[model samples]
Target: MKILLIKAARLKSSASRRHDGVMPPLGFLYLSAALKKAGYTDITLLHLALEGMGREGLERELERLKPDVVGISAMTSEAVSMHMAAACAKNGRNPLVVAGGAHPTAYVSDCLEDPNIDAVVRNEGEITFPELLAAYGRKAGFEGIKGVSYRSGGRRTDNPPREFIEDLDTLPLPDWDLAEMGRYKDFVPHSPMLYGRRYMSVFTSRGCPYRCTYCHSIFGKRFRAHSPERVLRELRILKEKYGVSNVEISDDVFNLDRARAAAVMNGVISGGLNLNIFFGNGLRAELLDEELIELFSRAGVKYVCAAIETASLRLREKIKKNADLEKLRAAVKLLVRRRIFVNGFVMMGFPDETVKEMLVTARYLWSLPIHSFLLFFCRGYAGAEMCGTLPPARRIDPKTDNTCFVPGGGCSSQPAWKLLAVKQLTTAVFYFLNPARIFRIFRDLPFRDARLFWFLFRTMSVKFFSPARR
Candidate 1:
């Protein structure tokens, strides 16, 4: 049977292009390769971003492909749009719509009978989905499928979760051949450093070792990584074949195993794959030392991003961040001395957080001598370790709304705004507070990308200086 994959349009609040201008849907590429290796080649992959397409344009493409099965990958924030896409695909027709990814995996029942999605895959579908589709094509009862959820007799059947793939070396590299790699040729995210060059993201590992409360822990607490050879092979392919110069290793924590980190770094260095790499989600601050920092620097790692979720020691302990400020400072200093840029990721407002604590975090974030900052609000998805701390209604709202808001919560106050007004204010305050220095730093950046830079700057400015009326 013919299978089609539909990539839903994601919200474009921030235009941070890392590789040239557009980023390819690598998740779909992985699945496409798996299906092809399983002997399913009658597949068509459609990226909504192509042709300047939106959701409706995707619907038109769906009608054009008209496959026997349709699969959509969704994130927590894009649930509403994904459901809409699934609804349009189903359209009262029987194309066997299926949903997967972080959102559907956590909210299986919600995604299953949402009137738009026919079924949901709870865990890794790379292997499970091929079997499910084979059974569907043969008109077999799907009760035996292991990792799928389906509506049956007014109740949902959630199959047991599948095991993680242990040997990633066996799997083929993602099927970039099916995608228009040229579209993603040079997209680069907005950043203070390396502003002109293009960079793309790759995953050398899956899962996280530490259980950060706010992170969606659907992947479980065990860290799994691809072999050094496996990682080097993919990196070489990305650099040699795709003209990719910069790579971002998007793992949950790259230094979970110090030895493995060294091996990967050494492999890249010895393999002669001299590509600029960024440990985007690699190492938390607590894991690195001077030796590791030196190794990473020698391995062509452009930037090291540490999870500096908060500066309040109590708040950091509350989230189980496990980051020690003193050690974090030392690591940052070492990287700074080595001329390597260090980026910090900070989050605000735990369930028990206070305004004062948030201010402390804001102040501490500005104090850090890092290359850049990425601030995010806490998200509580169902099945996450953090979800237990949140109130019940906010966990799974039956109201099928697109906008994610919790009344009086950290995110709700800024419902109309994508980011917290205070966070925006803080970012502006931090950046503008050093205007001449920032202008001097980014003076070499092209003027074409200034629109996004200025928009974010203005967004923060408007929210920062407004007075409180009594």
Candidate 2:
């Protein structure tokens, strides 16, 4: 069977290129690997953003490949692109159009509302996707396929949810070979700190136990991890087989299992891998201690992002982020002391968040030893617990079609302009007051991508001065 898996792109959006760099669509890659393992040989992976393809380019590929099935992976922001790609897929042929990813899994009925999409594979697709394919090949309908929502006789039907995969060790290491590994050379996400040689991302675990209200909990709230041996083996494959030097352990919270974390670190240390590791997604900083920090250094961890979503205790409880802020500060100090670059991940807006709370977070960040920080306005992405209370839709102005120079509306009780003011003021203050941090950025500035810096500037400048804003 000719199977085409497309990584949907937000081609028309002002999506940050620096943030969404040319990452090997790890989810699609895993699915391809699963398909291959299930004895399906005819699989092609197309990354729309990485390939710089628009609707026309996608149409051309659908024509050329003549695929039997077209699978599109998308986030909420890429929903429009997914539909556009699905329309293109259905244009030339009667191939099955399937949508899967955070958006579809979370809002299955809404995703199926589009006539073009035939089905959505909810949650993990490693097993269920192959089962769906086998059923399709056998000319049987997709009725009993667990973890799937499909159009049945012109009506939407959802099957029982599939159980989360327990033994992560059994899943194949992402088939970089099948993914055309060479094409993604030196392409990590567009963080200046993330620039390194031959980068790839690894997920040593699945699931997050903590219910961060703003998170899209596609992976269930249970901590599941590959064994220590399995973790080291995947790294070894990347290091020796693919020559991957820098890697991001892109788990939601990698150190949730302290023993597993310790064993993996010990294995990396004993194995002599020397792979430059980073935890860009973040780590549960409060979980770390002196030993864990030392183990991280020995394991070649170069960068870590301590996720301190808020500083106000009241706000933290409201959002279900139960992080110990005091411990987080100590963790940041330890990371910095070990010469590991640390960045703080913080959010500004919430349902009842006050300017006072926002300032509390800003000031708390000043007390940490983090070399840098990312302050994002909280978005009400579908599937998050925070979505209903703080709907981003109400915040956007149709005239500008942006959460932009928002006049009166905002996601939180606070106005959009107020949140913007707080973010800008705190950001400016954070940097201006910290001469040491400024020096760190410049010292490493020469090694960073100049194009990325300029592109970011251009994107922001255009957004601020566009005729819509004026």
Note the Cα lDDT for every prediction shown: 0.68, 0.77
Top candidate when judged by lDDT against the true structure: 2
- Badly placed stretches (over 4 Å) of model 2 are 11-19, 185-192, 390-410, 441-470
Q: How close is candidate 1 to the true structure, as a TM-score?
A: 0.85
**Which regions of candidate 1 fall more than 4 Å away from where they truly are?**
11-22, 49-52, 185-199, 392-425, 434-470
Candidate 2, poorest ten consecutive residues by summed lDDT? 398-407
What TM-score against the true fold does each predicted structure earn?
A: 0.85, 0.91
**Model 2 quality (TM-score):** 0.91
**Root-mean-square deviation (CA) per prediction:** 4.3, 3.4
